[model samples]
Structures are given as C-alpha cells and as structure tokens.
Target: MPGREIINLQVGQAGNQVGESFWNALLLEHGLDQSGAYVGTNPLQTARLDVYFTEVAHTNSQSKYVPRSIQVDLEAGVCNRLKSGPLGKLFRPDTYVTGNSGAGNNWAKGFYTEGAELVDALMDATRLQTENADTLQGFQVIHSLGGGTGSGLGSLMLSKLREEYPDRMLATFSVLPSPKVSETVVEPYNAMLSIHQLLDSCDLTVCIDNEALYNITTGMLKIKQPGFSDLNGLISKVMCGVSTSLRFPGQLNGDLRKFCTNLIPFPRLHFLMPSYAPFHDARTQAWQGTSIPELTAALFDRKNLLVACDPRFGRYLTATAIFRGKIASREAEYAVHDLQKRNSHNFVEWIPDNISVSLVSVPPVGQKQAAIALANSTSIQEVFQRSLEGFSAMFKRRAFLHWYTEEGMDVMEFSEAESNTKDLIAEYQQYQEASADVDYEEEQEEQEEEGQAFEEEQQLI
Candidate 1:
C-alpha cells in the first residue's frame, strides 16, 4: 500500500467526525482503506497523517461555532508503523482560554487571532523538520474555509501558511451556505472577502455552493425520505470528490467549474436584498459609479457559482464564462446569452432587463478555487460587439434565461451596483503591500473609511 500524508485542520464545532467521514468516503472511492493509525503500515502502506481540532464561540446564542484545530494522519499498520511522539501529539486537539466574544467591530481581528493559533501549532508540529527537513516534502496539506469557522478563522490560518511556504501547494475548499440557510447577508459577503484573501495565497480553491447542490441532490434523493441521506450525500460526494482531485498533482479543478460546465450553459447570478434595502430601486435602475465595485465583487471571481442572491431571492445575478482556460471572448458572450434566454422561456418572462458587468481577477494563493469576471474593451464598438455577440445568441437560444418570480413586496429591484474595478484592484494591491508590514491597523482603518463612505452614499441615494 502506498502511504500519503496530510495535515488537516478544522475550526469551530465542525469536528473530526465530519472530516473523517468525508475522508473515508474519498479513500473508499479510490479503492483504498483507511488505516486507523496515524502513520504508515506495510499491509496498507497507509498514508501517515495528523489531525487536530479547535472550537470557537458562536456569535449568536443559537449558533454553534467550533475552534480551529490541526492534525496529521498517516496510513499504516502493525510493524510498518513509525514511532509516534511529536507526530502523535500533533494530532491532538488543544483549547484556548479566550471567550472574548470578539467585539463586533473587530470581529475580523478576533478571527484572525484564532488562525494565528493554528499557525503556531503547525510550526510546533513541524519543528522536528528543521532537523529532519526531508520528512515532510512528500506530504500534502489540506484546510477548509467556510461558514464562521472556515471563512473567518480559516483565512487567518491559511494566510500564515502562505507566509511559511511560499512555494509549497496548499488546498482550501469552502462549502458556501445556501442562500435560504444563511441568516444574514453579511455572512456570505464576509465569506467572499475571506476567499479573496485565500485566493491570493493557495494553489487552487474549490467552492461548493450548498444551495445548488442541495437543489440538485434534494430533487434526486429527496431528503424527506428515510435513509435518503438526501443532500447530505451530495455534500459527502462533493467533499470526497474535491479531496481526491486535490490528491493528484496537476491543474486543480473546482466545483465552480463543474457548475459552469455541467449545469446550464449560463446560470443567472444576483445578490438578493431584504425589503429594508433603501436603495434597491435607485441602485438597480440608476447609473452610478460608486456601486460598481460591490456589483463586480459580488458577481465576478467565484468558482462553481451559478447565481448570487439571498434566501429571500430579493435580487438575482448569474455568471456567463470561465475567466481562465481555453474559453474565449466570443464564446463567453454566447454562453451568457444562452443562459439568459433559458431564464425567460416561460410565458411571463422575468429575466433581468439589464445585467451588470465588472472585471475581476484572483491570483493563485490562499485558495484552491476559481475566480471569474467580465471582459471589457477599449472602445464602445468593442463593448457593443461583445454585448451583441452575447445578446444575439441569448435571444436565439432562449434557454439562457429562466423565468421565475418572487411573491410579496419583500422582493425589490435595485439598480445593479457598479464597483470601480480599478479601485478593488488597488485595494487588493494595497492589502498585499500591507501584508508584509507588522502594523495592518492603519491600512484596515483606510478600508473601513472606504466602506463607511460607500454606506453613507447608499443612505444618501
């Protein structure tokens, strides 16, 4: 048996059971059995690995948050087992004494500290490496980023790893919450920014949208039935699928691409808003510069993304093309058009009359996912050419647009906001620059200022 090794970490209430079950499924799929031991054995030349767990406080009294922990596991049994000391202890979970309930204003900082702890643990676990440096070269490291545990804390942890091993590959897979299940709009937005931070650091990132998978699997498996396992099976499959894919050495494929390639040629993407949205109509219908960054940041640069919106289905946005790979400008336009047509095939078409576009990019880093954005040209003719290319095909295909309407005034229309693409790029660049400095507070203050100004404008509009 060939052995493999992985350093696994999880934050918050998401425990070992969840990670183990997911890993077991992946191993079984590959015709390999998991050797209970943390090191390699001859009969099962099992993968030697380590595992760790950490739990964090949940924000809402009703919410359950788990701390971030790290572990290393190896596959091996009996005589083949390597002596375990530091490696063994490394897999054990450790707890922190703080329940600070991180101030809401600096919640990001608290989360970042949790990640810092994980980074410290990693250093300790691998300390022996300085003397026996070759021991870790063959092993792969896997981490997750999603929900509260992964998104917030996970980003901090992964950012540290990037600093340690700039050349080594680390994979992060995020399980995005379904719009309906996510209680707050800010949760997903935070997830996106956390992802942005990760993307700047990892080899590749794969994102699995809970909503889309739930829809697909729930329909086929029907969770209501006993033992159906319903969408849970889909979740397992997705996790196992991503793990197996990452184990191999090559171009990393993500769930986002899966949605883009296997699902309808084009999927509508939109950001949903609550009835309380003050500028839904103003932002949606009126032309404005300030909103573009939010629009583009929301729409572009996500993997396996079909649409954007909240559980209320308050607003909708869809994706059109893959930013990377062989896909071209013309083909991308056609694909978007095809998706729009399908959305409006019904008698009373409700496909968005206008769609927003923005350019975005994600450098290979802290994430193991894909990023996408709209293409722009130097002149109006070029823009018109791409628009015509996309719209004409959409009108012809009709399948690109889907017809669906929301009930109640709870759903409101907002002008698709525009986020100055240039501004976002600059902010990203600034973050990169500040990342090296010991003091990030000054830069963070600037970001808060920017956000405040934007919010103030929203209130004014």
Candidate 2:
C-alpha cells in the first residue's frame, strides 16, 4: 500500500520556531542540503520524504523541492525571519500565512476575532495543499497551548480541520507552559481552553512541558540557561524519534494509526508522555558504550521524560517503546523484558500485557542509537491538577477576566471551559482508580443493579 501524505500546520511564534528546527532535522536525516538537494546517497535513508514535502519543478533545470507545510502567525516577524533564513528555499512561498496583529496572549481574541478572520484564508491554503496529495493521511499541528496564537488560533484551526475532513486523523505536538515560570499571567486559561478543544477534536495530543525541557537541558544536556533554540532542538529530536516509524516502515506499529491504537486505549486518556534516551549536546559527554538494556532502563527515568511526572504514582494503561538505530530484535526483546520486570510494580494487575515494543532501524542523522518511550499512564493527572489549580486561583480572584471579555468572548465561555476541564480531570482520575484492580468490573455491575432496583422501587411507589 502507498504511504499516507501528511501536511504540517505550524502556528504562532513557538510553532514556527519549532517547525524550523524540525525541518532542519528532517533535512539532515535525509542527507539533504539547505536547498533540499540530496548531498549523499545513504543506503539506510528512507524514501518517505514525499509524504511530508513536495518536489516543485525548477524553472531553469527542472529540479525542485519544497515542504508541504503551512506556517501561520499573528505577527509577521517570525514568518518573515523564517522566509529569509537559510532554509527559506525549502518552503513554498505561498504556505506562509499571517495576520494583521498578534493575539496579545489573549485566547479569546485569537479564537474569536483573529481566528474568525483568518479561517477562510487558512482553509484556502490547506485545500490547495490537500489537492496535491494522492492519499491524504492527516495533519500534524505544532503549537504551544499557552499562547494566544498557538492555543486560541490553533484550537480554531483544529475545529475547522475536523469539520472539513472528518475522516482524517489530527494530531498535535502541544508545548505546555510551566506552572512555576510562566511568561503570561493568563497562560492557565489559554491552556485550558486549548485542551478542552483538543479533547473533542484531536485524535492524539503529544504534550511537551516547558519545565521538562528546562530540566533536560540543565541536567542531562548540561546547559546552564538554555535558550528557546536549545530547547526546540531537543524537542525536534523527540519529534524525529516519534516519526521514525511513520518515515520508515517496520515490522509493527509503523503507521500513525497503529501507533495511536497501541498508545491510546481510551479517547480522553490520550495525553502521551515521551522520554528520549542518549540526549547529547556540545557540553554533555558522549554516551560511551551504552548497552540496549541500559538505554531501555534510562527511558524509564523521570529526568529523561519530555513531560515531568512521577509514573510510579499511577498505573500504566498502555506503553510503547520505539527503538531506533543499530539494535537487534533479540536485544530489543530482552530490553523490553527487562523493562517489564523493572516496571512490574507500576503495571495494573488486570492487564500485564499492556506494554509493547517497536524497533525502527533508521536512526537520526548523527546518532548510533536512540529510544523513545510513549506511555498513556495515569500520572498525567498530576499535570492537569497543577494547571487546574493555577486556573482556579486566578479565576477565583477574577484576575485577567476583562482581557478576554474585551476580546468579545462571553464570560460564560470561561465557565464552560472550566467545567469541561474539571470533567476531564475527573475522568482521568476515574480511569486511574478503575485500573487499580480487576474488581472494578464487579463493583460497576453491583452499582448498576442497585440503581436499577431503586428505579423499580420508585416506579412501584
């Protein structure tokens, strides 16, 4: 079967910057140059580039290359820099979409006003790109959940995409703001609003927390005070790891559909926690003689996780480890068995076989080995709890309420979003509790019988 075509939509400053790094990484991995010209013919390189990029015919020599991506921002500065940057020639000029002004970190303004204004133009660009695909797979949206353009406008685009292409899958690489160090005071509100929409619209949401990135840079990569570029580079590697399967077909879980099915069991429990091993930078020491077992063990470490959470506190519903680079299948099987033995304490008693492993032989540009562990564990509730507390604290004080109201959003919208978020948290908590033991089914059956008896008694009365 032919591989599916994926069009990338990057929104906001954070999105565009991350997209830049992602494309740069892609180029390096594919042995291509700044202008998309193949520099080396690596026998191991995969032939999946056309899925995410288009080959435009050159005017003079009939050679061409451009990314099948759409870049949007409320402010034109980031987009302008991207167009003028070294990799400018790799993007289609018409794919760069922008708006009149920035969203000013106000979700309501981005979603209600600016998003409404730009939806038509965004759809036009998307349709034009979609027409070129032989079999359109889905979309991968890169954005932060705390910024106005990323969260607000991103949410609006997600809803529209779902409406327009109901059958296609929609996934998001959502950059989550830190609860302790926030650039915007209303970041909690923005995050909640975006997450509410994501729960309803997106097929999968991969959350990358800012706090986790900070820790990884300072602790693992040993950067004193990492800049956005530094952090985005790390994120790009993780993105590459996750996309390895999609880029290179393997024995199991190569496509996005199978990947999602393996990781996400319940619809709302789709918040994934990823951890990449052997993270290296200039300052950090090279990973010396690390065995597959050691690398697999490192994946379970909290410090290596892309999102900060104590997995020990919650039960694992489903887990998938994607191993890339030079690793044997027997070695992978042994590593997975070792991981299972070590993680047995955290596995739910009902389902011991929830863990799975996929091996992708295609490694990153300059890496010998890498592993990404994606888990749908109940520990993500901690993140939701922290966000909810921050939101409730500010909402109770009625702080920053006028900013959204001034943007023409009804005050009731906040209440609705708050309610939805609370419900989501509760659902996660319920899943966690249900996964604790095998007796949950018996308890649910008894509760149903008791409720039916009460209804019968009421009818008799």
Candidate 3:
C-alpha cells in the first residue's frame, strides 16, 4: 500500500507529451528500467517507490511497478501514441481514456459539448486510482492553457476535482501561450478562461510559457530551433526537481501539502515562477560546479527563469528552494539567510524570512548537483496580463466569438473571466507594493485596540 500517494492526471496533448517525458525522468531517477522493473543498485530509491509507483509481485518474488497515473485527452490521437510508445507497458490499461471527437482548439467546444460528456468517465478512472492508495496525498495535473482540450476541458476537469476532493491539494503545471510561439488565433480567449478557473480551483500552479522555453533553448543551450520534445525535456527536469523532495527523503519538507504551504502566502496568490540552476548544454559542458551561494544567485537570475517575466520587476512574497545532491546543511542555511540580508529590497519587507529551503540527498540523474526554486513573486501576474491584453483586444472587436457561442456558451462568461483575471492582477499588485511602514501601521493599530479594551475594563471595575 502506498502512503502519501499522488495520483497524476495528465490532460490533453501537451499534458500527455510532457507527462511522458516526466515519467521517463522519474523512471531513470528511481533506477527502474523501461518495463518499470528495478534495475539499479541504489536500494534506497526503492524504499519510497510507493509514492508514485504500485508494485505487483509474481513468482520468484519478481515485482512489476506500474505508474499510479491517468492519461486522458478529448481526442484519441495522443493517448493512442502513449499506448504504443516505448514505456506503454508500464501503465495499466484502465488508466488510459479518450473520446472520439476532438476539442477542435475551441474552448467552448471542450467545456460544454465534448469535455462535459467525457468528465464522468474521467471521474470514474480517478476514483479507481484513489481507492487503490492506502493514503492519497493529492493530484498533480499537467496541461497547457493555449489549446482547447488543455484549457477548456482541463478547466472542466479541475472544477469537478475541486468539488469531489475539496480537502485534497490540487497542483498544476500550467503551460501558457507566448508571442514568440503563437499557436492559435483564439489562444488569448482559451488562456484567459483557463486562468479564471485556475484562480479558484488550483492550490498551486507552476507557470511556464513557450516564449521563455524558446529563449532558453536558443540562447543558453544553443539549440538552433527547439521543437516540442526539446522544450518538454526542460519542463520534465524542473518537474523532477520540484518532486525530488516528495519522492525521496528530505530534511525539512517531504510531502505535497507541506511544500504547498511553504510556497503559498495567500490562497489566491499560489502561482509560482520556477527556475533551475546551471544552464549548461550537455554537449558543450558536462555540468557547472555548484556552491550554495552561486546556486542561490542563479535561481534569482531572469535568464534562469522558466517564464518570460523578470523577477526584478516584482516583489517576491515567498519562495522555496529545493537543493539536490551533497549539500552541507550549515552552508545552505548560511547562504540563504545571508543572501536575503544583503538584497533586502528584492524581497517584500512585510513577510519576515519568506524563503523556505529543502534538501534532498539524491541528485538528479546525469548531474552532480541541481537546484530548483519556485518563487511566488508579484511578477507572475505579467503572464496573466499579456493574455488579458490579447483577450481584450479580440473581445472588443467580437472577433471569433461565434466559435465559442455556437457551442452554447454565454457571452457574459467572457466578461466574467476578464473581470476575475483583472482582480487577480490587482491583488498581486497590492501585495507587491506592501512596505515596512504598512506593517508598522497595522501593528500599531492592533496595539491601540488592545489598549482600549484594557482601559474600558479598568473603568468598568
């Protein structure tokens, strides 16, 4: 029986593709071969394999580890490929589900017509996975906001999940649209609508975009023209980094609920900016030497971020640094606190000691050291703002409104999405501008209230 198990639900094409890469990396790190059988000598890796893998024993005590994951799409193409893919044998047959008609890159089509129909089957499959776990932690959904299936249908699934599992923590690896890699004309609408749902439903969302992916692959790694596979590789590595603490034993935090609390300050401000250290091309260089100080600096650098927005423009409400490899506890603690002290302006003054750190003994495969930082900075609102601008521009003209309206969606829904998104953006700005003076004033007001209460009691006596 698995303890603190996380059932993965990868939605749509982008989600499934990224899920493949993510699972492959997990398999390698856990020392499991393609068939999900343990082949590595590291016995410690298998000690906690039950977090994501289910073991079945056969004759001679031979065990097969199947992923506790669900693969779903509105269309059959992506799921079919996964079924025939190299690692297909590792997944259970019942975990894979797909509908015949595609979402057609239209958010309304997926949400109302096609997606609503398949959500029941999706819930049934999810229930099966949860029943198998002795103690289930939560779900980690991977999908993009650019396409219909991922954005529209994905939102539909999220709403239902939140309703069904209200207490469970729901996290998402959400891929946003970018100007550099434009996919669909209606991407703005899809992205905005999805974000509105994410605001209420998701507990924590790690946001990444196509534009940033292109910049990193072309600028840092020196890839000429990075395709979807190359981009997904970067995402998979970061996902691995984020999960390293949960998958293995960590010093401070070792579970989804704990880390989610560490990274999130407010309920609505749970979006994080993910960054990885040592951006080196495998061909040109093996890996960079990592010091706690250097790794910390790299994480704050805009170039190392997986999103287009600059962290310098906004204030950091909170951050979590997960360090993998042989990190000295004393050195890491000193480095993080010292860095925060010297660059006090970079972090919001209202939150005291906002950054949290976690250490993992095992390093990522094929690397000496690695660190991933998830920053809940105000600048992440830039991602939403960009989509809002595009969405407003199109909505003003009533361009391509029929595609959604014909699918039985009301016109007021777009208005609601836009208003909710703007409110979120405003909320971030409110926190970003919070200062030491504001905290001091708030504390003085609290003291005055206490003093008044005491004086009234004395008079009454």
Candidate 4:
C-alpha cells in the first residue's frame, strides 16, 4: 500500500468446473463479499451476479469437449465479478483482452465489431476506479495465459489495457503447465507469444507452475485423489503470498521493530517446488542415501538459491537432500565460475560463499484454507517463507512471442522449397518445370550425338 501499486486482470475461457473452483477459492481468500450477483452492465442492481463478460458462446464446436461463454458487464464491481458462479469457471480477463485470431478480429483485444466504442468507455472507468481507490492500499492483478480462453482472447484484452495506461505498473502472474504432461499444445505456444508481448508491457511477471506444485503436494499427502484440489490449494497459497507481500508487517523483513518500518523490495523470482516424494527415479527413495551428485546435476543453477521447508522432519529431509546435492556438483562449480567471470552471459548468478545464509520455515495452513493462510505467519517466518514462496513462484509464470518470423537471426530459416506449407501444392509445380527442363536438355544432347555419329560413320564408309 505504501509504495507498491497492483492492478488485477484475469481472462480465459468463460466456463469450466476448474475455473469455478479457482475463482471461488480466490474470492474467499480476498475476503470479497459475493452474496448478490447479477450479469450485464447494471451496477445499480446488486442482483446476485458479479462477473461481467463480453463474448457469449452460442454454437458449440464439435472438437471441443467443454462449453463456455464470457460477457463483460458495462458496469461490474471487482467483488461482483469474481463472485459470479459462471464467470469463476475458466474466465480469464487477460486473454479476453489481448488475444488475436490470426485473421482480422482481435476480439480479445477488448473491441468487437459492434462494440467498437466499448474501448474508450472501459479505459475511462478504469482510470476513475484507480483514482477512487486509496493509493496507500497497493493493488494486485491476476489473470491467465493460454489458448481458447487465456491464450487467444485474454491476450488481446491485455494489450488494450497497456495502451490506456503506459505508466502504470502491471504485475502478471501466469500459470504454466507441467513439462512432462503438456496436453495442450496450441495453448503453450500461443501463451508464450502472448507473454513475450506482455513482458515489455508489464513491470513484474510472476510464474506459477501448477504441475510441479500438484505433484509435490499430492506426494506429501500420499493421496491418490484428483489433482484439481492440489491446483486450487497452490493457487490459494500463491495469492495469499502475494497479498502478504503487498501488506505491511510482511514476510520479507525477519528482524523488525515490533511496529513495522520501511518497505522491502518485492521478490524478483519465485519457484514453487513440490515435495520430492515420488522420485521420478528409484534412486531417491533412501532419502539420506540418495546420491547428492545426481541431485546436484539436477538442481544446480548459477542464480541465488533460497530453500524453504515445512520445518517438520519429513519435509526437511527432502528439502535438505535437494539443497546439499545441488550445492555439491560439477554444475554448481561451473555456475560459480560463470558468475565470477565478468563477461559471462549467464542469466543466473552463482551463490556467494561469503554471504550469510538465511533460513525460514514455512507455516502450514489448514487443508482447505492453507493457500489463503500464507498471510498469517509471523515476521521471522514471513520474510524467508514469503520470499522463498515468491522465488518458487517464478516457474509458473510464462512469457511468449508477440510476433513470429521464420527469417529472424535466432530462428532457423528454410528455402522456398523447404518452407512449403503443403508439399503437394508446391511439389507438383516444381516437378512440372523440372521435368520439362530435363526433357529439353536430353533431346538436345541426343540429337547432337546422333549427328556426330552419323558424320563419323559416313566418313568411314
């Protein structure tokens, strides 16, 4: 609230069960009252609906297994929007505003053919709202980056928002899929492109890896249930961590005067590492006996390392193994060397040996409400725990390409023949020309040789 300013923007597909759960959890965490929600742009009526969406899904695509529609209310409160049951399910504000269909219409860019004037009106409303809010209370904006909803339409909306407020700081928290199981192909690539566009537009970008968190927490509980619960919990914890970081008496300052003082710099990177319980390999089962060498190979990085655990023995055992293994490895040595090299282009700097290490034990919250409860820790735990929490959060946010060009220096370029989209389309034309040229050359050579042979034979006769 003192110096930080947060603007929240969420976009994506309009309807889905997972979306619903996520929105519900987020609203409860924010302490927003959502009793009366109403759709459309009538702010006068606090009638039982909060979310205001723009697009409505009428004709269902046969290829799609899920159905959804999003409408943006001409007048809808933030609290009202998140409270909407339908809006909670897969509705992403970021995607809805910034996505382009590769064709003509960037519907997600906040302007439809019919609603061309909605752009000016929306900006005016946003400006007014910010002025109304107490500047002392910093803000936060949340949204999704994916295909269909998040990747497509949501990205378009984000672009429009940036145009309106070039100076305002925008912190976007993006959720990334697990590398092992990237079921959604188009979304990943599309989302990456969208993030690349947003990187220049936003101030800070935070990443949340749903897969990594889900895998870790599930292993911790040894539960065989669906992963939706784990995802929700992770989201909650992330949001709570965000809320705590934004507030005073926050987690970043471990030793503080009881009353609180100056603000701490927000985290630069956050990674959410789930437990190493389900060893991707069989070798990690013995915990202590687990090869530190292998772990070092796996986790070593040039950048600063911050490790957090539950402070309990079981969780500590896994966290310690990972840290020790990472601290001792060839990769670690290389990382240190690279850091010391002045001209090194390495992105992650090596950990300094002389620097004093800081440790913070994360406070576990209730099963259902743990995610939101990250805000309730003491100053000591909050600094390390919250900072580490933010550090791990980096893995989840994603940046994508804003524009594509095969001819770029970094991209592999192909000749016309190699670049053909439909091989048949270009192949037939190539063959036709090639065959004609070959026939003409063969005939000319044959005629010349025959004439020479005839002359020689005649002379001999």
User: How does each model score on TM-score?
Assistant: 0.40, 0.93, 0.97, 0.42
lDDT per residue, candidate 3, 27-86, as tens digits? 999999888888888866887899899998857687889999999898899889998999
- Using TM-score as the measure, what is the rank order of every candidate, best first? 3, 2, 4, 1
What would the per-residue lDDT of candidate 2 be over residues 17-74, giving only the tens digit for each residue? Answer: 9999999998888777889776757754536767676776666774455778999998
lDDT of 1 by residue, 362-390 (tens): 21221222224321101112211222333
**Tens-digit lDDT track of model 4 for 1-461:** 13233334444432122334444553343233232122223321112111122223334421111111222322233224454654444443422322222212122232232123344544554554455334412223444444334443344445666676554545444554434435453343434444444444544444444444555455543455636655554554444333332322222322211102221112221112222211232234344343433333233221111113222111110111112112223443453344325322221121222111111122222221111111110111222233223322431342221222211212221122122212322332232233335667899999999999999999999
User: Between candidates 2 and 4, which one is better according to TM-score?
Assistant: 2
Candidate 1, residue 40: how far the Cα is off, in Å:
14
Q: Which ten residues in a row have the lowest lDDT in candidate 3?
A: 281-290
For candidate 3, the per-residue lDDT at 212 reads 90
Regarding TM-score, does 3 or 4 come out ahead? 3
Name the regions of candidate 4 deviating beyond 4 angstroms: 1-5, 14-125, 136-139, 178-183, 227-229, 251-461
> How well does model 1 score by local distance difference test?
0.33
Give the lowest summed-lDDT range of ten residues in model 2. 280-289
Backbone clashes in model 3, listed as residue pairs: none
RMSD of each: 20.9, 4.0, 1.4, 22.2
